[model samples]
Target: MGAKDGRKGDPEGFGPIEDQFQAIFDDFFRRPVAGSGRDRRIPMLVSLEEAASGASKVIKATFEAHCTDCKGSGVLLGGPPVFACSVCGGKRHVLQERTLTVKVPAGIDDGQVLRLAGQGDEAPLGGGQRGDLMIEVIVAPHPRLRRAGVDLFVEVRIDAETARRGGRVNVPVLDGERRIVVPAGTVSGAEMRLAGFGAVRLGAEAVPIPAEVTAAPYRSRSVGDHRGDQIVTFVVGESSTDGQDDTSEGRRAARNQGLWRTGVLAVALVAAVIGAFVLGR
Candidate 1:
């Protein structure tokens, strides 16, 4: 019956039924705005060496993409005009996994994020621009090297003989190994600095430096022109007995020696006071 006839048996008119179907179809097949895409986070692990020298890392991520079956229209074809897509529950997107390689800049600190434009989820309806992928860098700890800003600190082991007599110690730098000269009577825990051998300065471009200032030790230079220094701390290792480690024993001995010197100084001060009192009497 026509909608205008208003038959008694007809519950709702054809126009209202069509309008209701259209509303349901519109809700099921809604399209997102252009240039809108899902944002994603990717955790990237990097070694100290990789952070020192820039590297490219690959990461795998899963995101929503426009459905291929429905062609982002959320409607089925080849038969009756189905308002909603049965495969995607009327949603126009499907889950997809992808892997991408990201270039990590040199001198990137831990917890820093790198943004990759248009690498995230694909835009809905296959028309708008894709979203961005954020890469979070996690720098792994080195066995010997500790990072502090752009500076690197490392502890080198030396035998008792080398600690007493002058010797050359091999220190690991970012690029290669550097041999450091140890003066005679060098004590344990002594630190030596090697200029331009540390972490690269991030965000600093290359710039010219003065020759005289470059020669000066402990001069802090800008990011691009100069690099930080590598600080090497000497650790004196004692010979072990019965194939047992002696590091703890050596540290205890060093502490005892300090206490003994302190106790002797205290005794000397007390004796000096007693002597002066007696002389004044």
Candidate 2:
């Protein structure tokens, strides 16, 4: 024989080996590999009350997804010209809009991030894996309340009479109004604690306190799990107006006082007119 026409055990002359190599190469390219796509980060703004109590928010985001027309291959299949896909322009992925509902956990702090897996860009070239979406939580500043860690701080303005007589004063809480006791002889800048009424601790199970349980003592002890206390700073007289106008009752009281003063002035004017007329007679 001039030369061996084929290998000793192969009669088909490398056809099967070529087919096997081609199959392996196709499989390798089709499978998802690392570094296929990029993760995306977005900022989510939420209110302090929503962060404290946890809330569900709808968000609209743009992400890269596999091109449906070309099946993410970047090129048109079964084409004699072998041209790039018109839809994706050979990028293999297209930008698409997605609406997602995000669940913000209770006690989530500002600048914290929430990761959602497989919500970012899809892998290129029809790869299966997808990147993650990072949601950075941005907590808006509260008007009457401030937060430090899990503790909540608020300035409460009380009348001089309530401070002297030791009465119940309404304090602002996350859920609603909470009445806190003002001790006799309480002075301005006095700090009081409402236990188990602050922001929920991270990773701690907590439920919203009932609205009926309004009265919380100044030095109340902690009663539940995964909760921080609300710190109340008292301000007497007209020194501050941080939390005074937050309550409707305060507004109503001010209105009533104004009306009473106006009525007294009218009565005094009428009495003066009558006295002048009687003196003339």
Candidate 3:
């Protein structure tokens, strides 16, 4: 899929999920398959089915949904009549904010959830503890870099000068300062990769940007050895300095990506390549 330019507004990340786990009545066995790999402790995703006559599995899915408005007291913030809940006495909650930072363990895939205890609504009658709050994590898309598990994809633009002569370039990556080598005649939209620059893995390798080949429009796939190349798109420009300075943040980032220089190099490269072919033949 084509990536939307990152130079635009920074896409707002989906906020955290801070409520109860919505139950799926049927049985859910979050356990490993009978025989798959050496990892026995690894959990499996078993679908739940409603049982008929008899069954050995059962689940008690209980949770307290927080009060939507006055934040758990079921009262308007203005004054008296629309006032205090007689039970908790306007204190709002019978439980404290669940303070367990809740470890977001690695290997946990996207949309995975982490639960924190006592983070929901308290009993209206008082005395009992609160409900649990679940946080769901989702991976956000990167404008320039594409993520594949623990790997990252970064796209770099090379000008006719950098492509034909080859040089060092500063590229945008998950962890910045990724110095990349622009090969001679590198062409436009060519990608230079930094190995082990991907997301964090569990233990053995916390995070690694894998070395594999890349593809996609202004995108990177595995950085490797194959028919993969950095795709280049060309744009013709009217050469003149009569335009105002690109003061906006987005324009500046585009310029840093060498888009301005790329336009010039594209025209120049075509002329040079044609001249060489004709002269050589």
Candidate 4:
């Protein structure tokens, strides 16, 4: 009887039902499954030496996880639903803090991010898959050194006599101090290269040491067979004096010239006074 009414018998009449099924399938696939949390990004600060040599560091991070009290449903299931979950307050998740030990790769630059799989937030009532955690690295500035890509630059102050005579001088290195030869007639801002002293290149086979071993210096293989160079720039004079002529003779000459200028100024002031008195008379 329904076929006779042209409702069930027509193929076009089934279009609305097929469309409804298609819509249902699409919605089911598009919705995120429970327990799949969002990814998070956090910052990690490291020293220049630490960045050059890979090390494991412990860091604290906060993220969200499904509430264990309500099982992520946001309500109590044992009784008739009357109010939200007391633990999560209907949010389905709670903030959780955890300490994680992360490996910082050698030669890692500032603003670079390292991803840890499944370390992000836990899914809220979704599936068991957690999101990834991204750690953005921040390299601290060194007191006497500046970094450019894989190269490191340092300014070493040398006296005028040493700059002219050319001799060995102590310069700072990543581990400690080292002596480098300076050629005769070397001027200020002259740069000398120390090969294999700079940072390790990224993607090198660098192995990280344990956190406990960080206090004691350990070299990582991440430097591979070759490393970047450290460029030493020679600055003449004492750094504390702001690039002034620091030689003893130079200081004595400067004082004598200052005294001569003071005497001349005094003499000019006395002559002006005598001329004024004469004009008044």
Candidate 5:
């Protein structure tokens, strides 16, 4: 029998109810699929100070978007049955360049990911939605400082005399240079803490602490303005003054001369007193 000569009662063209049900069941049991467009990761390099203090950055990238002519439909506007779009060539998406100004929050650690919603490529077939753009932050290495969690570590080089006598050294911070006092007899790699002078965490405000108040041993803590500490590691350095006169050295020399004169005068007085006593005897 020919293929077209099938009997009406025994149909071979249409599938059985069981087969139809099986097909439906297989379709329903299929695994869920993710979105078509892929997410993009961009590396952003920022200075340590900038990471401490929140800053803004402008990002420029090329992404896929729905064609303006097709309006994401992949069809032309001319007829009842739509025609393929000439501009996008039925792809419905076009390559586009966009710029976004992203605000980088404070205390954003290295390798941290920042997500920008709907900033990635558009769906390929017929645009429905877009993916996200992820920004990975990278903190650049500093010459004299490093960060651990929220705390900042700075290596300060000071003269041996200054380290022994507890003098001040200029330390660099986010805002500016601060004169940090090195305790007397401080050794190499000794860390000194500067409260409220470290990196600012995210969502924390920068408060202006008064000098007198900071100097006070007992000060009340405020809310919503938490600041980390700066660790100043002292490195004993030598004075390299060949021709220029160091003020500290000059003062020390003058003080030594004065002490010598005083000692000589005291000895002469004692000798005179002994001579008088001997003559009286």
Candidate 6:
């Protein structure tokens, strides 16, 4: 018998018989009303150089109402048998744009997050917490500058002549160009210190390095001095010299010629002495 009939024994002949059961549950209890969900969002980012934003400037951020066409939903709405989801208004989450002034604290490391309080959208259901918006201050890498911890490192290539001769070398500093004295006999790879030549320190309130010369001594020793190291790889001349045998008569002749010239020089000296004696008499 059909579900409406009272007969109980395998009426449809599909499976084992069972006692009467309660399988029907109402679907209307789960449908949500309009404005039921808390706020949900996706954000956009804009990055501009610090100098680009002039003084006395303010940036405003705002959110738009959900689109009525697609109802803030991006998807194409409406089909015959199956209908589109109405909650996203056919557009997914409604937009809730917000704005906050991003403070770039000095000496903040790259990728560090700055939290904006109460700036994010509200939670969808139950009036839960608003989402947190994090802003990161990125100091773009300088093409010429290399940074360490509080220490900033810079490399300069000095010619061997200048190093050996010892003279003034120009080094770049944070604010301006500086002249540093490179000692005489300074070898390549020698690191000389120009004090106070580093990046901005975050908290400690003091000028970093005083104007003082830090000599990185070389491993080369000349009796007594502090020494580090400078690896100097020499390029040897591979072209060989032509062979000359000492026993060859040509060399003997050359030697004999030199002896003969010395003999002539001696004779001239003797004559000069004799002439001096005659003049004295």
Which segments of candidate 2 are over 4 A away from where they belong?
Answer: 1-36, 73-84, 210-222, 239-281
Q: Over the stretch 187-267, how does candidate 4's per-residue lDDT look in tens digits?
A: 999888766677777767553322222211234444325457678888887432223233434455567889999999999
The 10-residue segment of model 3 with minimum total lDDT is 18-27
Model 1 Cα lDDT, one tens digit per residue, 36-124: 67677878999986776567888778886877777766566564755555555445567789878788787788999999888887776
Poorly placed runs, candidate 6 (over 4 Å): 1-93, 96-99, 122-129, 205-281
Report the C-alpha lDDT of model 5 over 132-168, residue by residue, as the tens digit. Answer: 8999999999776788977788877777776676555
* Prediction RMSDs, each to the true structure: 14.5, 13.6, 21.1, 15.1, 12.8, 18.4
- Report the C-alpha lDDT of model 3 over 77-156, residue by residue, as the tens digit: 56565544333233333323322333445334455554646544444324445444555544445456555444455555
Q: For candidate 6, lDDT tens digit of each residue in 1-281?
A: 12423444565663311211111111112214433432323232322222111112233554333445444232336643333234333333445555445544334455556566545543333244554455544546654445555445555555544445444555555444455555656654566544344433443332323343345332222211211111211111222121213433334556788999999999999998999999989
Residue 136 in candidate 6, Cα distance off native in Å: 3.3
lDDT of 6 at 116: 62
Q: lDDT values of the candidates?
A: 0.66, 0.73, 0.37, 0.70, 0.64, 0.41
lDDT of 2 by residue, 1-281 (tens): 11122325556566433443343356346545644655889999999988887889999999878778878665667786666565665556678899999999988999999999988877765566678899999999998889998889998988775566555667788877876566767798998877677888877876665353445443334435777778899988743343333343544556778999999999999999999999989
How do these models rank on TM-score, best leading? 2, 4, 5, 1, 6, 3
Q: Rank the candidates by lDDT, best first.
A: 2, 4, 1, 5, 6, 3
Q: Which pairs of residues have clashing backbones in candidate 1?
A: 204-224, 205-224
Better of 2 and 4 by lDDT: 2
- For model 1, the stretches where C-alpha displacement exceeds 4 angstroms are 1-35, 73-91, 205-224, 239-281
Assess the local accuracy of residue 192 in candidate 6 as a C-alpha lDDT between 0 and 100: 50
Candidate 1: what lDDT? 0.66
The clash count for each model shown is: 2, 0, 15, 10, 0, 14
lDDT of 6 at 243: 21
